[model samples]
Target chain A: MPDAGITAFADWIATTSLSHLIAQKLWAIPAIQSVHIMSLAIVFSSALVVDFRMLGLMSTGQPLSAIARRFLPGVWIALIFATISGLLLLIAEPVRSLPTWEFQGKMLSLLCVIILTLSFQKLIAARAPAWDAMPGVPAGAKLAALVSIVLWILIIFGGRWIAYHAG
Target chain B: MSITEFLQALESTAFATAVREGAILFPFAESLHVVALAFVIGTVVFVDLRLLGLASRNQPVTRLTNDLLPWTWGAFVLAAITGLSLFSSTPERYFTNTFFRWKFFFMFLAGVNMLVFHFVTQKNVKEWDNDPVPPTPARVAGALSILFWACVIVFGRWVGFTL
Candidate 1:
């Protein structure tokens, strides 16, 4: 259960005119959600490309920095879109979204994945030349790639579970 | 039996019932479907952008496609499986939904677009693989693929609302 402070905040948001407007509009939530899903596709796929390169599963001949340079910008841009649409969703259903464990867990996982992705990018920037010259990518970079993949999958699952869980 | 009877029977099956009524089964399947779909669209978007010369301009088209095709197909298979499972859970509802019909129609178009790209546009891939921008046919295929997939996602989401 959410604490009193959180519950009160959710209640207050639910009663707001913006929330009321969103709730009254039948197409609003689904439209926002479609944008959210599209943005997620961009972010997740871009991350997958970078991670795959780090794992040496694909594009091994290409420099890691090159792959990162190509895909990371898309990831960041899509993240901005996802965040905006996701916030609209939250504003539309504060009571339904803000007080739920699934929602909270999804948010937490999202934060961790974002941090992990940033660190992964920094690691590539600092070590790409050395790693590219090696016969194979370093184990540490591969581990980070693996962690990033798992965290993304978990975050996706968490997003779905939020709908299923009682609010 | 008639189509309606068949659909009713399918929906009444134990597996379908379990998926529809069970606490976790439906959501689990949906989550998998979404994840798999994200990868499918994601990989496809990367290739499409390459075709349009919007990104990865230095990478050869054939090499990029060769590298990403396996992941795209792999994720596509997963999405299909999960999608079928979700459809099975409530056949009649989806069958009656206009958005659901549109979703499948767009998916079919996407498939046709891929076939045309592979069998027709890509016949001369070697000629333009190294080019920053692909040939017109390849670019058209890429644009159509992105549009079709976007329709698929939009209609797919609308199905839930309309149902």
Candidate 2:
């Protein structure tokens, strides 16, 4: 069983006016969901390219910084959208959302994803020129890419299960 | 057979039975589908963005497409497999859903958009391959492609909720 604090929080969210409005509106959930999914595509696609480069899978001829500079804007923009939509979805039905194991798991993965992405970006920025010249990226960089991929997969896994598990 | 019959037949198959009935299988397939979609759309964005003259301003278009298209094709195949699996689980519902229809229609358009670029504008690709911005035709193809795929993603997500 979840702790008492989580249950109380879930109870409080269940009574919110926003949650009631979301439940009443026919189009609200689907519209928000569409935006969320599109944001997923944008964020994942931009990150996938950079990660692919880190893994030595593609863009072998280009420097890491060169490719990253091209795609990071898309990533950041999409991430902002994803965060907003995700929060909207959460507030729309936090009672249903908060009690679920899927939500709990998704939050964990999301936390890891943010940390990994930020740190990896920092690492790339710090060693931009040196990393670009190397034919093979550092082992650490590849490991970060792999970990980021795995965390996202976990996020997707938990996300797809949220509805099924939600109270 | 009628269209409904066709879809029903698809859903009635042994594979579909497993997909629909197996608790773990459906969600697992969904996760796979999301992963594949990320790769397909992600790689395609590079080509589209480059054609738009938005990113990778210095890279040759041919070089970018050559390096990226292979991975895109690979991911496309994976997406098709996972997508088919998802469809099989609820063929009748999906067949009737407007969102699903829009998704496929836009997917077809994206395919045609790519073909036109490959066969027509790409014929003279050598002339503008190194140009900071590609010519009008190439840019149009890129822009249309981005539009079609964006619609595809929007519709694909809507299908889940609508169904």
Give me the runs in candidate 1 sitting further than 4 Å from their true place. Answer: none
Please identify model 2 stretches exceeding 4 Å from their true place: B1-6
Residue-by-residue lDDT tens digits, candidate 2, A28-122: 88778778877887788777778888898888788888778777677789889988998888878776677788988888988888787777678
Q: Model 1: how far is B8 from its true place, Å? A: 3.3
All candidates: CA RMSD in angstroms? 1.7, 2.3
B19, model 2: CA deviation in Å? Answer: 0.6
- Tens digits of per-residue lDDT, candidate 1, B1-163, equal 9989998998999989999999889899999999999999989989998998887888899999988889889999999888888888999999999999999999999999999999999999999999999988888998999999999999999988887
What is the DockQ for all candidates, taken in turn?
A: 0.86, 0.63
Candidate 1: residue B3 lDDT (0-100): 85
Lowest summed-lDDT stretch of 10 residues in model 2 chain B?
B37-46
Clashing pairs in 1: none
Q: Write the per-residue lDDT of candidate 2 for residues B35-154, one digit (tens) a residue.
A: 788778867877888999887778999999888888889988988999999999999888889999999999999999999999999999889999989999988998998889888988
